[model samples]
Target: MKGKDKCKALKEIRAKIAEENDIEYVVSECKHKGDCKGTCPKCEAELIYLEKELEKRRSLGKRVCVTGLAVGMAATVAGCTPASVIDPIVEFFGGGIGTEDLAGAAQPPEPVMGEVEPPIETLDGEVEYVPDSENSSEEDCSGEDCSEENGSEENGSEDPNGGSEDGKGDNDIPDLAGEALPPEEF
Candidate 1:
């Protein structure tokens, strides 16, 4: 594309990016109670400042990219081949020069292969097991009574009503207050 068209496209893309960034920032700030309709005045003011800064950065990036493209194109058209354009393409893509191209030159000596030595052992001996001094196993409790040494039984077998000491069942079902309701005829 022509330089002017490229610049226009770049500027449009930059403007879109800036708009998206500002929208995301606004959404995040509003979520944190920054927008005027949401909560504090100070946060709203800060949001406005951040939006302006984003706009300024976007404008600058577009201007710089366009200017660089224009300068590059002009230089190329004037027969000034830039090292930036040529060097990378040549180094990465160009095939190596053939041996036929260097036909009468003295060739470098072939690389010599050294003998492979066996790998040395690094460890002196087998691993030894070290028992931990503070290894304490947890005790298994019987169903009858598993209370700790200082206090009451863990189960509620001592309660006469077959309920807990607090009068609550394990399933937490409340006791019926009076006689059960009569069965429905259906």
Candidate 2:
């Protein structure tokens, strides 16, 4: 072969080798860049799969952030509403609602001085009254007399045989005091 023709043939063979190795070089470069714009069919498939995964992750992140914001705004609005706002509406309905009606009614009743209204009693029959003059007045008795009277009333009502008024054994008193006493010797 002629020298020029031989050189041309060698150059053509090198060019073919370089063309074959180009795919490998492109892949290496793409890997170094942390992403791939794959030129070959296999690498392009991998890159498409990765892009789909990244898109799914981004959508999930957006959904979570939006949901969190919605929940936070709802909580903030709920907390901001005045506790007193419901009171007037409840009171205007004749004061027979929940705690709101009671709280509203409580303020007005407190300020009106004198002539305090008596508590409504729930007894079935007409109330009986023992007059102050008829009842024993605490002012007439000394402190000692009052104490003795109270003590006598309690002790006199108690049964002597360690039993109650209903003739049942007294469950409240322990047997320890009786156990501690020595037996009587003749």
Candidate 3:
């Protein structure tokens, strides 16, 4: 298409994208009129923005399509119905195929009488929670060990005098000698 035609198409695409994405774009009137080359800075910037947004949406659409295709193929391979594969994708995309759309759809099979369900098992066969007498685990801290110890590292306590062994905790300020101190700035 010609430059003018392409620009027009892009504007239309941008308008559609804006509408779908709940965006608002106001078009300004061309001041150049007959002398307009259509490649003005404003038009070029808009063109770039629209192209990028379109590309982003196109990539997302492609990803969704690919995902849906893979899921459909996997469902088919797993002997699942098309509706089983398609319904979830439709729901996910905020769309739905109504009962009317699924005319002559296969009904799910009813459970047979006297059907004994198999017990669920883990990789190690049956999962049981048996406690070992040797390695007894405690859920909570209790007894003398549970109580906070004096001068413990966790409590940040260094000495019984509330300071380091040589005296002065982190919050203590040191006395500055007159000559050692820097002169006050005016």
Candidate 4:
């Protein structure tokens, strides 16, 4: 993307974000906060002037910053110390009223989930599942002396070759039973 195109795209996104965040609503909320003992004319005038300035910027196709919105919504009135500590926001509605918490006011939208094709493909045009070697332990056969955790023989007198209690293998041919299995048994 070219620089000009990217800038235009960002400006478009900024307009959308500004509209969705609704700076006017936040300003109204701030003005309604009960910190002002009465209708302070100074604070009201300052807020109204800031709102006009923000509106002018918007009309001129400029991107509105969340931080600026917070500051614009600030309510500074006389008889309130330096008056910079005052704000209309419920989150930081005290002497610390500033653009510090503006970032939290605007949250990004959540992602959407949808079905899609699998990423894998083979020469035969099918998705074949090949188990990973490191994680595969089902085929790990040590021998008859292995622990019963791997389903091997216990400490019983039965045949280590995996024969039944009646001294017969699973095939039931009744051959040489009660004997140790071959070293490389499957």
Candidate 5:
């Protein structure tokens, strides 16, 4: 339902609940903190529950409106209108929507000159048959602190686990191997 209608329905439900609780919807000093002057706690809780319900209904209505607008836009983008465009698409896809004579109804226009690039060619014996993917650019390997023109190597780091230049398990970090860790807490 629309937001206004849903809100009205919620208001009716609130009125019913208020009547059942012997609560008077007066313009008293109601701070809306589960406290109503000269009324029981049940009345205050019922009003709060009704308010939340009304808010949920309004939120749902807004979502439904937005979803409907999105569906409408999708339909337009998919060419749902203008039966001319749809019929050609169906015939082009071999659905045979129209006569067999006009098979080129949806044929795409010839691409403008130089708009499309020719595929890369590899000479049988003139050049090695290397796919474009196997080649790597310098930018692909040289990243932050890639010391040897490659990716980060945790094992070859400055830490002790990384073997030193002398081929020993030495590190530049402070030697705290003898220090004990803090005791584990529950």
Candidate 6:
């Protein structure tokens, strides 16, 4: 329902209640008549009066369902269209119309997932491994620090053959007494 329709419906309900209680119903013209937000003095007074009458009816043990009327009036007072108020209630009761009403304006667009291609296939039904040159820049190292030259004596080893006396030129392993564990443990 639009604002006008909601206002009309509220007026009809108010009239019906007034007629049932022997109260005279008067229709006053409002400046915002067609697009009444129910904030105007006339509409606010009518809603308050109607609420009071409903409270009286409830106090007298009369069963009155004020849910629809109250919500409609509240929505109008808050300057919201009736559809914005009613759509969620209709949806809560399993009505599918709400999604249609809320589709474009009220909802956010869905997220998109990137597509990944499979590895290259080979004739033997196995994925072929092609090493990329940009990803393979590993340098060969033989000592604790790759920055050290092969014949450097900074390690306090006087023997020039990497602390090895065997003329076969085999490098001797350094003392690991105070050294950290190898990277494989990590």
TM-score of each: 0.15, 0.14, 0.23, 0.18, 0.17, 0.28
Task: Please report the candidate that would top lDDT against the real structure.
Answer: 6
Q: Order of all candidates by TM-score, from best down to worst? A: 6, 3, 4, 5, 1, 2
User: Model 1, range 97-175, lDDT digits (tens) per residue?
Assistant: 3122134632222212353422322212222222132122112121223233212233211221243467342332223
- Candidate 1: where are CA atoms >4 Å away? 1-19, 22-37, 63-186
Instruction: Give Cα distance to truth, residue 97, candidate 1, Å.
Output: 89
Query: Candidate 1 or 4, higher lDDT?
Result: 4
Candidate 5: RMSD to truth:
34.2
For model 1, the run of ten residues with the poorest summed lDDT:
134-143
Q: What is the C-alpha RMSD of each candidate to the true structure, in Å?
A: 35.1, 48.3, 34.4, 34.8, 34.2, 39.1
User: Please, what are the lDDT tens digits per residue for candidate 4 over residues 12-58?
Assistant: 44344335433321212222321222223333343333344334333
lDDT score of residue 25 within candidate 5:
35
Alpha-carbon lDDT of model 3 = 0.35
Better of 1 and 3 by TM-score: 3
Please say which candidate is ahead in TM-score: 2 or 5. 5
Return whichever of 1 and 6 wins on TM-score: 6
| lDDT (C-alpha, whole model) for all candidates | 0.31, 0.30, 0.35, 0.32, 0.33, 0.40
State how far residue 170 of model 6 sits from its true place (Å).
Answer: 97
* Model 2 TM-score, 2 decimals: 0.14
| Candidate achieving higher TM-score, 3 or 6 | 6
Q: How accurate is candidate 6 locally (lDDT)?
A: 0.40
Clashing pairs in 1: none
lDDT of 6 by residue, 98-178 (tens): 222233432211112352422222112112222243122222222244333223224221221232245433322223248
Question: 60-129, model 2: which lDDT tens digit per residue?
Answer: 2211111121232112222444766668766677563222233343312221234453332221222222
